[model samples]
Target: MDQLLAQLPPSVVALLDKWDSNVLLITIASFLAWLVWKVIYNRLEILTQKTRFHWDDLILASVSAPISALIWCWPATISLGFILEDYTQSKLDWLSTLKLMLVIGIFVWITMRLVTNIEDYALTQKNRDETTVQAVAKVARLFFIVIGALTIMQSFGLSLSGLLTFGGVGGLIVGLAAKDLLSNFFGGLMIYFDRPFKVGDWVRSPDREIEGTVERIGWRMTIIRTFDKRPLYVPNSVFSSIVVENPSRMLNRRIYETIGVRYDDSQQVSLIVEDIRSMLESHPDIDAKQTLIVNFNGFGPSSLNIMVYTFTKTVNWVRYHKVKQDVLLKIMQIIDNREAQIAFPTQTIKLDLENAGEFAGMQPQTEHQQ
Candidate 1:
């Protein structure tokens, strides 16, 4: 290789001898590196546009690999000493250090970029479940960071075992600092694997009273959008531990109503219950398969309480409300026709005092002059 290098034309050799110190060489090298990267990356971008695969688009969108390659090639042209070494000892040492830094930078940059590409690809696979994708992405990122850090350390001539020993202590401290965060993370994983609730589920937790649609299942918490347009973020750990009531998942909805009748109107109570049952059975929305129960539940202080239990054909809230409204209107009409009134809580109090007389003889009680 040395003989071949020496055998070149005088002008070419002269140019190479000057290559080490010539500012023009540095500029040309930079321009060529940039030109190569531009051409290759643009071609990738064009290819991405022509293809229909989203994964390919993601790969093209992150052009870090090409950029890393261009960066790695730059110092090789001037720093190998054989290529061009004209500087004094101090300048050469500086150049060497710069080259080493560049090498470390390229190593870390490429590793992270490739990791990003893999994560993007993993996200594109719809066959993989959402929880799997999240876990994979997290694991991939951690792996990339560790590899990058180790590569940089090794480039500086440091042993990885020493770093790992230090890292063990550091990791312990970090774990202690983030105990709750880790708990939430693992809780989220359990929730995902257990399949207790999914996106778009309506869940009610003992700690939280949520009546809304699920918007997202994130790493530490689940987001629910309430009916009032407010967003609630409940920790996944709480959801995993608590009882979750999913109204949407119910097969059929039970409609229970308590209607009261005046105590004196006892004779009409049975007739009203029978009429209500008939109305429920004849209603278009009632599920006939479900057993309907109508009974005199109990007697209140001022009224007879009747329980009407029936199931609606559908579980949708709006439809259930419509059916319930119709039934309620019919019950009111029947009560009006029978001239019976719905009872309210009532109490009568009698005030009697021994010798019921006003203070200081202002007035005196008189029970038929007794």
Candidate 2:
């Protein structure tokens, strides 16, 4: 730059000499940095967005502004160093400290933005579940953060030997600092070992309001998709404290119901029960071996209540419902064969004999006639 300026006319050189060389350098660098920042943020960013790769776009979008700021400050830092060399060592001692702090701080800031970008991008992807994506991203981010920190420290004249000597105490400090994270990590390990549930399992917890299909299980959390199609993010630590019921692993789906017949059909109760038992015994869908029970449980006010307790051969939710419908329709056909009608809710009102004359039009039976 000095040589280039020396070739200029004497008038221009005199004009330029009015300002200190370092200050002039900084001024020129600042203007150049601004132009570069505009091209990067406006032009290059647009170009990156057009690419098919997500990493390319994310890297540019997340780190561009910080990098531009770093560029602007770099020239000033160099000028400051040059000026500090002429001053007393004690007076300019903070320069190295400032550079050290600035570099580390910028790195941390840039890394955080990068991690956040990755997380957001991962969620929009359909190929992987949220739990798995976040798990991999977090682990990678942490690894890079540690490595970057050490690199920055080394660059700032800090020795790795001094850090290694604090290993025992550092471990304790890290454990204490990340107590909840470690708890979740170990909880994830327990899930893998104990195998309470796996991906695609329909799990519900009596302890927590967690009921969903396990989409994916990460190191720190699990992703569940509820019946209503909402995504649920639960920490792995929660599994350790909660009781999860896995219905997907069940051998059969239960079909338990109570059917009633009008009192008029009391004579057909025994026949109906026998027919139902016979039908269940021969039914292909019903598991007759699994403690099947079809009997007249008791008498109700308006009808004889019969209990139907049995399991289906299949555990599939949709198929189980279809099987249940078939069984119920068959029972209806049996009742029709015996000329019995299913009873509905009914009530009786008894009025005083003398007062009954005043309310003569009122029916004694509420839901059904006797």
Evaluate all candidate structures by whole-model CA lDDT and list the values in order. 0.75, 0.84
Q: Residues 220-302, candidate 2: write the lDDT tens digits.
A: 88899999999999999999888899999999899999999998899999999999999999999988889899999998988
Across 1-370, the per-residue lDDT of candidate 1 in tens digits comes to: 7798789998888887877556567657667777787788788888878877776676555555646465546545464554334433333444555566566666556555666676667656776565456556666667767776677677767888898899899989988999878878888778777767666677675555766888777778878998898998877777656777878778888988898999888999999888888888888888867989888899888889989899998888898898888888888898778889888999879866754555426434454357
- Which predicted model would earn the best lDDT? 2
Count of backbone clashes, every candidate in sequence: 0, 0
> What is the Cα-based lDDT of residue 220 in candidate 1?
84
After the best TM-score superposition of candidate 2, give how far the Cα of residue 265 lies from its true spot, in angstroms: 4.6
Identify the leading candidate in terms of TM-score. Answer: 1
RMSD of 1: 7.4
**Residue 307 miss distance in model 1 (angstroms):** 1.6
